[model samples]
Target: MIPAMPKPLTSLLTLLLIAMAPAEKLRSETTTDWPSFRGPGARGVAEGSTIPTTWNADPESETNDGMLWETKVPGLGHSSPVVVGDRIFLLTAVPDEGETELNIAAGGNIDAAKDSGAYKWMVLCYDADTGKELWRQTAHHGEPKATRHSKATHANTSVCVDGDRVVACFGSEGLYCYDLDGKLIWERDLGVIDVSKYDIGWGYASSPAIHDGKVAVIGDDPDHPFVTVLQLTDGEEVWRSDRSEVCERSWGSPLIHEVDGVTQMIVNGFPWIVSYDFATGEELWRLEGGGDNPIPTPFVSHGWIYITNAHGGKAPIYVVRPDARGTIKLDSEEDSDSLVWSVERGGSYMSTPVVSGDYLYLGNSNGVVRCFHAKTGEKVFQKRLGKDAGVIASLLAVNGNVICASENGTVYVLKTGPEFEVLAENPMGEPCFATPAVADGVLFIRTTKRLVAISEPE
Candidate 1:
């Protein structure tokens, strides 16, 4: 028989045990997970109020004053770095220098570079705290038969990650899904890409978007012109939407947003800004007049959808509403009830626009950054960011500054206001086409040769 315990002793023990139990972490909207192309919910707005208005005093010192960690990445890709909890993921291609076998089955050509061998697709994972490489997943290695512009790379598309898996699409090579530990789960070959028209442009750059338990991709190949949805678990084809005309291939990623209370995936491709019901791949509305090769991802806000086409002959910013779904005519100048407004002047051809406080900001390929009134389509301000052109990366707003990264490796930080005030110009010393990702007060920047992490000194 055990001796009876004292009431006071037992009660104290219970209280101590309860207090020792681990507390559940609170979910934060301000401290967000930069999950997709822009950020959580596909909205570019970051939650915190203490965003750095001025660049940290010292960028090079490792002092905890602001910068957390900065590290060098393996290869080159225009794809931006995606951040999850403690890990940041980036996709790149390692160019082989000599005698590489050609994987012609993937699509297109197999020309071996006499000097540089073949380009191999690689996905990199880095530690957010220390900037250490966690693991590297090499998807494929072979001589790319197809040729892309000198500015493009094999791994130009950004990678998307969910809970335990990371997904990346290497055009012509295939779509690959890997576990957090670098284990290959599944792969789907989209076949070799035909780039004969655009001078054999680089494979494909449209990043995949996950919505409603499905991974959706717009595989607008000339041969198989369709927008397909696949099961996120096993990579099985769920449904494919067929279009009458073979849509021209573009590097723009599809945007998923709710318009007038209905969830829609708005895509700006060759000929139109087509809206599809997110539940089913059914075309809901189409706005035909746009630029020739629409590459920038479309953004939506305040019930109106904004879209732009870059070098496309008739570049225009189309304001569309889903209310006029089936009744509006495409070429009517009588103000189709669906199209609220269309502005052709001062629109971006390559970079996507950033919306903030009733204003929209955009940077063209020529390094000119402009702001427009979101509702009235009024031009607010336009200024040149860098002396040379090529502002392909999208604009990002965090804290109170509007950030734009140039291809030449300069990041211009300006206050988000009516007048353009250059706060600070930060350089990574390498060329970059990837956008910046801000998390936990640190900024993740991917240049052609390395991935750098900057933060305010503690």
Candidate 2:
């Protein structure tokens, strides 16, 4: 015999049910959800009709007219913000005290003003409409093992959101999963992380990509050079593939593409752009020519895979034809036949190449952006963006405009064409490393100190 519930209580229960209903329904819609590092297929291309090409072009205004909303963030990070419908997610970290010990371990000179106590891993949730912080999750409020020279606080990785579950990887700390409302689901520890190879550099920065039902993570540990795929529902290890030729870990994100009805997971790490069968985690094909430290994600177009080795000692773009069998090497002149063409000048070190129609565009860390023909790998146009601006974030194409953010928190919006056209330059006044996310007419930019929303004025 249960007692009758009050009317207000019943109404509240009904409201709660309505709120939870959307989370379940969102699983059915694919295009609106950016579930991985660079959106669907990891292509960094968003599909929607409302992306803006020109907004607030005049820089003389006292306030940003077309800006939607802006909110300040805690700490700094190079990881980009991920969007899933109305909620935007970002990862950040705050370093701990004992400046000398942590700095020494990180292989850097101690700076009293820059040192902050015990690193705190944070995941923040903001309203995509108003740029308001709805909730935050902080993990492991302690000092990290060490830091990387060019690494940021939130350099662990970007967030991947699938329906109600959002996954974020904080190396050394663990991998975390949260519900859409910011409730902790589960966290898995990957063990102690050390940067012995890159001279005790920063932790992992590869964002996870989800395909079919597994989340793919490239764990390039020296003892275990493998890609780990986990079940999306329960975070269980599905399959792990290990191969010979141990390569160093890179900051590049993995990409998923379909070629001739076969789905392949393409990962560009140091020394290789290895493709794996999405379902079984089997190494299908490998294109080896990257530098000793590959950090940019590979872009595919015109039946060719374009990859650049940032510090490969040589500045050359490796264009490989993926129509071959296992492990194609471009070491010799004969082997270079499979290679379409290699451009040795004006390549990128950090920024991933963006393919717009038939042209491939890339910005190097030295602020030089170049465009190349997609079919023949021929250089089309090149221009220097900022005099001293170094780009650590990938370029974003929205409504015919190429939006690129720099490490100094300035976003240069240029028109994509055979020639460079500077449209607008917006500054957030803080360091930024994450690529911009454009969806449903709104542009999302995450800086070290804030998350800004730029859109057409109402």
Candidate 3:
């Protein structure tokens, strides 16, 4: 005889058991999409994938080599590549060498910015499988309206994708959108944005974060700073909130997270780590005593937010707990009701760190890699990368391997745990300033001139 169907309440209980299983057991056993600056949601963690422990991209033959494919892109931009399905999208700023370049050495730890007399901002597409150029769309072309720091470029901000629409923001130049086939949909000229640190001319570099059919941008210009959300379908303004608590430079991109059934937009600023309500652009919560020139992206993990910045001043790493409401502040050296824990001294100068398993790994400007317990703020290990590697690109985690690339072109893979173990040090033979993107066991790394894909031998 056939067994009788389970009752409604019994079926509901069975479904709950499966839903409450460990994440590893219930994770979507599929290759996820790397659709934004630091992959999906900018969490910097790739689920269910194993990247190559060692690989090279200089091979000439197309046979199963370390280099799957390499494509040389025109112009200069530190924007990271985004991958969706079979295509990869990227942005560039072709320098018109005939014109004057705005090359300036304004400060420390950054290369002087150079300007070509005239420039062309472009949106290019490539085949993710073979690195073949699919299409190139020029978004804007003319003399730059704003200046750039020596270490920054015209196209420093990465483009973001939402289904079929791709949005690209060329600070001061304009904000443009295009369909998947390179058709221009809508454009908005937001005027010249004076994004500087202490009135120093550093180019803007914050990428837009797309969520729920809206694009959210955090512009921390010293004059008339504001955070606004726009509708993706028609470029209509949804909401704009003026920021009154910023005084220094912040090139970090904001992040969108759904916490406790409410969507919050979290941004890292000079003196405040602020969270805003996404629906109405209302200030939900704020944290004080942040870095001076914050460039690291605000990292949201589990239910906490981790941020760090250093400008020779209040260089701190703050671990924040959720359930924050209204105004909040924490002492520079003490933990409080909203702060889970904070490190008053040690933090990264640039490059957003990544969390793997139970430990958080950070790589700094001097290539010093450190590990800390994510929950209790316990120190695990601190080891210099040796050779003065000096890491500017952020770190990422792939299947328990913490991937960190240095400025001088070495990708260090470390095992994730309390004890440190050097998994592999893969050198790319070029200066890497942009972060790498991981999808389906492949690593797409952008050096100064080319975007190369690395994967296991086919």
Best-to-worst TM-score order: 3, 1, 2
Cα RMSDs, all models: 6.5, 7.8, 6.0
Q: Quick one: best lDDT, which candidate?
A: 3
Question: How many steric overlaps are in each model, in order?
Answer: 20, 7, 11
**Best of the two (1, 2) by TM-score:** 1
lDDT of 1 by residue, 1-458 (tens): 99988999999999887677654223233345687777665556565734454443233434433445567766667778788877888888777753222221122233422325677789888988798999998899887655555556667787787877788887778888888778998999877754324444445678888876677777666555567778878889887787536366556787887655777887777665677887777887776645776778877777677777766357677777756564246578654667776687667877888777777888877778888887788888988876664577888877777888776656788787789888987665655578778777777877666677776656
Q: Report lDDT (Cα) of residue 451, candidate 2.
A: 81
lDDT of 2 by residue, 31-89 (tens): 36555666665667665535545444223456665677788877767678788877889
Instruction: Write model 3 residue lDDT over 1-458, tens digit each, in one string.
Output: 97776799679998999888876455434446788899987988887887788765533434434777788978878888888766788888897675223222222544435564788999999988899999999999898887787767788888898888989988788888899889999998877777876556688888998999999887778786788899999889999887865434578898888877899998888677788899998888887755677899988876798888877577788887767776665653333767888888678877898889989888887778988898888888899885757777889989988988877667788888998899887777666778889877789988777889998876
| TM-scores for every predicted model | 0.85, 0.84, 0.89
Off by over 4 Å in 2: 1-31, 48-61, 96-117, 154-156, 195-198, 222-224, 331-341
Q: Which of 2 and 3 is the better model by lDDT?
A: 3
**Model 2 global lDDT (CA atoms, 0 to 1):** 0.70
Task: Report lDDT (Cα) of residue 455, candidate 2.
Answer: 80
Model 2: number of backbone collisions? 7
Per-model C-alpha lDDT, please?
A: 0.71, 0.70, 0.80
